[model samples]
Target: MMDGASQFATTMLLRPWWLLALLALALLSYLALRRVRGLGAWEQAFDPALLAAMERFGHVVPGAARRIFWPVAVAAIAILALSGPARRIADPDTFRNLDGIVLAIDLSRSIAEGGSLDDAQAAAQMILQLSAGRPVAMIVYAGEAYVASAFTLDALALSPVLAVLDGEIVPNAGSRSDRALDLAATLFSEAGILSGDVVLVTDGDHLTPQAFDAAAQLAAANIRVNGFLVEPTARHGDMPAPDRDGLERLTRLGDGSLGNAADPAPLADTIGKRAASALAKGETAALFFRDYGRYLLVLALFPALALFRRAT
Candidate 1:
């Protein structure tokens, strides 16, 4: 429950500076009425006999309410209308475009052994940073897939969750892009949201034929799968051979492009642009406020109309 003054405050001008001008209008109207009535404009305009002839013999004489009262009332109502009275109101018809992005990380031993897991993690963080203010989810996959973080707009909140992804989390020893893609699709289905992109961060050492099928399905649903191939930055190393063809094929099937983790800035820019474009295609409803000035104008009409009526 609000105190009387607090309740009154919200019912009036949101920007109270306008009220000063409204008060001035009211004061000017009062002063003008006093000056005009003191000069007796009606009396000056007509003779006493003419005024007596205009009044009906059997009818009641016009009182202050029928004369000064209605004009004052009209002026007061007009002043109130101009004062810009407003309150916080909900308008549920507002809309905006928003999209979600899912990051699928391969946690197989190959990524751990090749020492490119950090590369994948770094790529994911970079994507997260580039795609700020967008809903992001994380999935870690080895032989099976696990949701490291649910879909959310707060990318920072999911950073810790992404930091813990490793081969140990999955307990299995194999990598299956099929499993990861399938689970990511299921997450999208459950969330009932349109995603701008699905980012696959992996060495692609264990990509199966089924991964292509999954990518096709995702593409059919308008969810593009972008791939990040985490490669060794050095010229010669014992790093496991990344399945370049597999990443290329998966991205092709998913209507997406493959990116190198070594240089993620371009990839981030590409994904960011595409995601923003995709997100712009859809809109979501939200609550807002509508001004009541027109309603006040309608309300002011009642007192204004009364000014033209004769007293009975």
Candidate 2:
């Protein structure tokens, strides 16, 4: 049953959108242009020739002497990138070339019902595909969670672990994601898993307050959490997992909670993109585009007039 607490529609995340910081960066870039010895030197060397040439263009006749900023601007922007443009994209995607990752799957009773099996199958496929030869550790939790598969990027070797998931596995343990997440965190903390990534797949149903607490704790660690929700409808063999109130709270905490009403297909695809993007952006684009996109443009519009006459 949906509880009033879960119904409270407050946004859960803290977003520090850097609008002001970006404006400042743009302002600074413009100032840097003012001090550029290269542009000034180039202007001193070619300004006379450029001005004389612009005077020939009928249109330049009106302001021929004043239009000498275009080529210098292009050169400046390219120079900026050469100096450090890739650094600006700030947050770009990254390849998982470093270490093996963990894929913790939910195998509680609910996973077998309500079209959840299909979702489970799809999630498994995505994990294996995305793992890309990185070692993956699998865990299944219903009421109780256990390591079904150890860390191995080889998905083929992990099949035994994934296939063991079923509703009957948990018995009377009761649904508790906290335990599952706790296990994952602990697993990753092991010396071997300390440096790799972590992927968690589950239906955000039957979450207890403890789950959210556990999720909050796990997030504080360096592990990356990605959720794949399996469907909850009755058909397809899903059973009575707990109600929704607590699960909603858990979702708010994990942020990694990815989903579509128990459908893993979309969750897998979306989380894959987000994880890949977040990783890449952090390494390359995040620092740049997150704040410098507009600042870089200031130099462009201000000095573009110089090159326009020449190109024409």
Candidate 3:
């Protein structure tokens, strides 16, 4: 019960200035009602008994006085509607573009020295291009993770950064995609994005149990982690083969798909479709209060119809 009261107390008026009109309305209603009840200037000029007699004899219609109440009631309802009372509500449609894309590029030795760095960069760039107009973030990780670029709508701003990314840029020396996944989740939280996609571009050479755990956590948080496998060139035979099985399993746990680096169209399409699906299901962060004044205005129709009927 206390919680309910606390929630109700949070309701606010959007147009509080409209409330000042209520004082004027109250005064006018008082005067109008007094006049209807035969308590106006006429009451001062004539005896109370005389007015009572006039009302009794039908010289003054008591029913007409009662009719004034309807209009006053209508005006009060209209004034309240104009005040714009509202409270915060979980309205996913309130932020249609809250669904975003986070590109987590693996900058480990396997990707940088395995002859697949170009493929990783290309895959990142392709996803960014296809995800135009959407809020996109970038995470570059090897032994650790770093947000190369925060959420932004301009793909061009991130394209150049992706072009220059390599395993050497990150001082870390191991592969930890798990850290990347965790960092992506943090990014979404900081940006107030409730649901989004995480595109992991990697050679898939370092898959760990921790990575799978991170993917499951992301899925729980409504963030899908898709895989972009960057196959190494045939000449680089010493590099470990891409961990296709592990990548596929990670994607499955994250409720996402695994795509080949050679063609990013399907991966981009999947991201787009999933984001749209989340939005269609009203899965988004609530960023603002939903105004309920318009709904209150609907109640005014009752008194309005009464006034209309009386006038006719």
Candidate 4:
């Protein structure tokens, strides 16, 4: 508890000079000892704890908790002191093309096919490379949209999530294009948000008018909804499919004749291409926002911090 007070004091001062608390306390101890020697009558008046406590007062009162408060005051202040945010030093240079992005992938039945999954994964890889390790959010859409992952730059962690894209995960007995499109908008307005592009991955077959309307809504919110169609091909009997028709042309739909992912190589190549193009854009990336609670991290520690607290 007293450690917290010391930390708070340091934070309030925000000055390195306050670190001399120990030296100042030592000098005070010398002066006090001199007085004690002068009054040689009452030698037993000072106990060890009392003397030590007095010394601590000299240091802790002014230095230990000069400005800090709150239970996590030490942790919070340390975080602020060590690597201060956006601090401009003498020769400051910032990296180029850094931004947040959200990748809204279609997990409809059509993506279960060979080519669809490949294109989607490739797109993610390319985006990761372009973002220079910026946080990316992941959303999977089918008859509905589910957030598979949250915003992060951990590329390796995202690989397994990208691997599990099938009709099995989301039972798309009938494609709900409207629902999927709405998910796009909902995804953007979520936690750990950053300004970036939104990449929609799906076969052109699912393209419906309603989904286009939803995309337009997202675009209006500075979230660019770019379409990536996994076109149907006759290779190994794989066909092309896209979620929505044109944003304007609802009734008149065009044939989505694209690549055939007979083998995994072609599928991988396609996904890579789309992802590369989208990710290369400096302000574009993949955002994977998740709904994980703080308990997960706290549980790793003595989560009892929340379970029990001071009566006051």
Best by TM-score: 3
TM-score of each: 0.57, 0.51, 0.61, 0.44
Candidate 1 regions exceeding 4 Å error are 1-98, 232-240, 276-312
By lDDT, the better pick of 3 and 4 is: 3
Among these predictions, the greatest lDDT belongs to: 3
What global local distance difference test value does model 4 have?
0.48
Better of 1 and 3 by lDDT: 3
What is the Cα-based TM-score of model 4?
0.44
Q: Would you give me the overall lDDT of model 2?
A: 0.55
lDDT at residue 184 of model 3 (Cα atoms): 94
lDDT of 4 at 18: 34
Quantify all predictions' global Cα lDDT against the true fold.
0.72, 0.55, 0.80, 0.48
Error of 2 at 120 (Å): 2.3
- Summarize candidate 4's per-residue lDDT along 131-230 as a digit string, tens digits: 4444567777677677777667664577778776666877645455556556645655664243345555555555666766665665555455554555
Q: What is the C-alpha RMSD of each candidate to the true structure, in Å?
A: 11.3, 14.5, 12.7, 17.9
Candidate 3 lDDT over 13-118, as tens digits, reads: 7678998998998899877877676555666797889988997997865435767777777787788888877776644333535778999998887778877788
